[model samples]
Target chain A: MKRFIGFIRKEFYHIFRDRRSLFILFGMPIAQILLFGFAITNEINNVNIAILDHSKDTSTLEIINKISNSKYFSIKQIISREAEIESVFQKGKIKAVLNFEKDFGRNLIKKKSAQIQIITDATDPNTANSITNYINAILQNYLQEKNKSIQLDYQIIPQTRMVYNQELKSVFLFVPGVMTIILMLVSAMMTSISITREKELGTMEILLVSPLKPFQVIIGKVVPYIFLSIINAAVIVLLSIFIFKMPVEGSLILLGAESVLFIITSLALGILISTISDTQQSAMMISLMGLMLPVILLSGFIFPISSMPAPLQVISNIIPAKWFIIIIKGIMLKGVGLAFVWKETLILIGMTVFFIAVSVKKYKIRLD
Target chain B: MKNENVIEVENLTKAFGAFKAVNAISFEVKKGEIFGFLGANGAGKTTAIKMLIGISHPTSGKAKVVDFDVYTQPEAIKRNIGYMSQRFALYDDLTVQENINFFGGIYGLSRKAIRQKSKDSLVELGMHEISSKLVGSLPLGWKQKLSFSVALLHEPKIVFLDEPTGGVDPITRRQFWEMIYKAADQGTTIFVTTHYMDEAEYCDRVSIMVEGKIEALDTPKNLKQQFKVASMNEVFLKLARNIE
Candidate 1:
């Protein structure tokens, strides 16, 4: 045990003394979180729009006022002709164009309905869809206010609620994803590269010949990573809670334990990678290409796994990050206990065991 | 028990698929002798050394290193041997003192022993002034000598050096050999492999491996007389040509 501690101290020296690695370890997590939180967002706000109102009437004016008052759209241009609407959209700042038919209020009074054309630029579908939805919501609110004195015989109202994130704060989604990426990068990539570095420098042969057992050497290399990864996990959690107002609804102790378990699982993967790669560059390439892509795309960080093709959904079931993201979301968003996350926890445990077993077998073969 | 040989091998052969890397090689080193293993590149010298060090398993036959079976008691063999590879194995980022302390600590030396050894090694090498400097700042020759000293820090029964003086100058190689002699005088057996044939002349007994087999095993003087060559280098060339 004392020898292992000494080995860990040496590993820490390697990590702290290298400036480039230190920068990557701490700087990347915060930058990624802030970027994902502020820059890349699903919620649409202050989208530039144009309007072509042929009828200068009370109803059209009131509807325009309603759209501008809502936070989603900003009236960038008021075009008098239909030809001007296409040009404004061609400029690319205006995402949607609203056109009210001639004599809209007169038609509404006589026919009980008026046609208002909503034209959206379909080149960027998601933003166009969001702009259309926001406009519809504003019109619905205006009609509801105007119909306060009269009761309609036929009406349809749809009620919707966002459960886990009521405010739809993107940080709540990004927090768990960012934590998973950071833990995986630091614990898996760093440990694998460090071990392969020893092999490249020929120090591994010396260590193997020493009195220290093979298992002891591997444990010593990974123990420091576990500690550093835990510290990284803590930093991400604190940033989420304080800066983003993301709450931890479940038990903090269970969250911490599960995070450590995931960190161990990642470290085991690192060992497994190191066993296969003889050089540091190969280890890094394998970690980045093999692990990072699956964690980002297939783990349901941005896209819903259930909505993907069947083959991709089946492939995602084997990714450890998918299970971890579910565990973290359950704990942080749903305020759930161990019973709710036991299945994910078991998957993580199984992956950890599998990685360890394969690596141990490979390591023994190398000894032979 | 005290008179037992430190290393013993009998027809130890290692094969990879159909190709034999080390073919039926057998040798022994006494408790305190500078045994040399010499060969040209790809002559299976490294493969044989690896098996003796218990890192590679032989496909057939048996071997005992430091009185521990290579097949079953590898851990015990590892505990009794120190190794330095062709490449310098010290951590370049670590300071001279920290490198010594780390290797010593892993070898289960006490803190006091590590400190004393570090101090003594630095003083003996005339490098006490730069004891706190990073090893990357040292010259290649100095690093080579330090590596050898670090390998013997735990006072193992046998120290295995695979081409310990590959790229250093002759002066440094001579100094390194002097250290080997000092360790051997202290009853520490030295098993070293080298491509420098002149170094083979300095060993108490020498073995020359060619194409996965031991072509010659005797003192340098006997090999020169037997092969009718003026030097061990010519003897190696003749045997290499015959194999071809």
Candidate 2:
């Protein structure tokens, strides 16, 4: 145990002394969280929109005021001619164009219906759809308020509520995913490269020939990474809680335990990677290409796994990140206990065991 | 046991699929003897050394290193041996003192012992002033000598050096040999492999390998007289050329 502690101290010196690694380990996580929080958002806000109202009536003015008053849309341009609509959209800043028919208030009073066109730029389909939906919701609410006293037959109204994230904050979704990627990159990629570096420099031969057992040497190399990754996890959790107001509804202790388990699983994967790759470059390339894309796409971190094709869904089940994202989301957002996340917890444990077993076997084979 | 041999091998052969790298080679090195294993590149010297060190398994044969079977008691063999490879094997990012401390610690040395030994080793190398300097900043000769010292830090029974002086100058090589002699005089067996023919003369006994077989094995003077050559280099060339 004293030898192990000494080994860990050496590992820490390696990490803390390297300025580039220290920056990447600590600086990148906060930057990623802030960037993903503020920049890449699902909630539409202040979308530039153009208005083309042919009827200069009080009702059309009131409706336009309602659309612009809401936080979703900003009236960037008001075009008078019908031909200007296409050109305004071509400029591309205007995401949606609102056009009220001529004599809209007169038609609403006589026929109880008026035409309004919500033309959206379909190039960015998601954002365009969101802008159109926001406009429709605002119009529906206005009509309901205006006609509350008049009873009408066959009225249809839909009620919807965003269950888990009531505010639909993108940070809540991105924090967990970003945390997973950063931890995996830091723990697995860094460990693999460090180990392969020893091999390339010939220090590994000396280490193997020493009195230290192979397993002890491996554990020594990886233990410091576990501590660093835990510190990283805590930083991410604190950032999300204090800055983004993300909740930790479940037990904080369970969250910490699961994070450590994921970190170990990643570190084991790093050892397995180093065993297969003879050099640091190959280890890094394998970690990035082999692990990053799957974690991002199939882990339900950025993209929903259910939305992917069946084959991809099947393949995603093997990615450890998928299970970890579920575990974090359960603990942080849903506030679920161990019982609720036991399945994902078991999957992570199983993966950790599988990786350690494979690495140990490969390590033994190399010695032989 | 007073005449204990640090290394013993009998018909030790290693095969990868159909290709044999080291074939039916047997040798022994007595305690405190500088034994040289010489071969041209790809003559299976490395393969043989690896098996003897218990890092590689032999296809068919038995070997005992430091009185422990290479197959079943590899850990014991490892504990009793030190190794230096062709490449200088110190952590370039770590200071000299830290490298010594790390290696010593991995060998299960206590912290106090590691500190004392590190100080003593650096002073012996006349590098006590640069103890805190990163090893990457050290010259090649200094790095090689430090690596050798680090290998022997645990005081193992045998030190296997696989081409330990491949790229250094002759002066540094001579100095390294002196260190090897000093260690051997202290009762540490020096099992070394090298391509420098002149270095073969420094060994108490030498074995020349060709095509995975030991072509010649004897003292330098006996091999030269047997081959009727003026020098050990000529003898190695004659044997190597005859094998081809």
Model 1, which residues run further than 4 Å from truth? A55-59, A101-115, A122-126, A140-149, A152-166, B1-4
Cα lDDT tens digits for candidate 2, A1-368: 87788788888888888898888789998899889888987779899999999998988998999988998889999999889988998898999999999999888777777888889999999788667666767777777877776542222242232334357687898999999999999999999988998899888887887778888888889988888899999999999999988888889999999999999999999999999999999999999999988898889998788889999999999999999999999898888889998999999999999999999999988987
Displacement of residue A367 (Cα, Å) in model 2 is 1.4
Model 1 lDDT per residue over B145-175, tens place: 9999999998899999999999999999999
TM (chain A) per model: 0.90, 0.89
Give the clash count for model 1. 0
Q: Estimate each model's TM-score.
A: 0.94, 0.94
Q: What would the TM-score be for candidate 2 when compared with the true structure?
A: 0.94
Interface RMSD against the true structure, candidate 1: 1.0
What lDDT score is found at residue A26 in candidate 1? 86
Estimate, for each residue in A1-368, the C-alpha lDDT of model 1 and write its tens digit.
Answer: 77877898899889888997887788888888888888887678888888999998999999998889878789988999998987888889988999999999777667777889999998988777666666766777777777775543322242232334347586888889989999999999999999999999999988987878889888899888888899999989998898888889999999999999999999999999999999999999999999999999999997889889999999999999999999999999888999999999999999999999999999988877
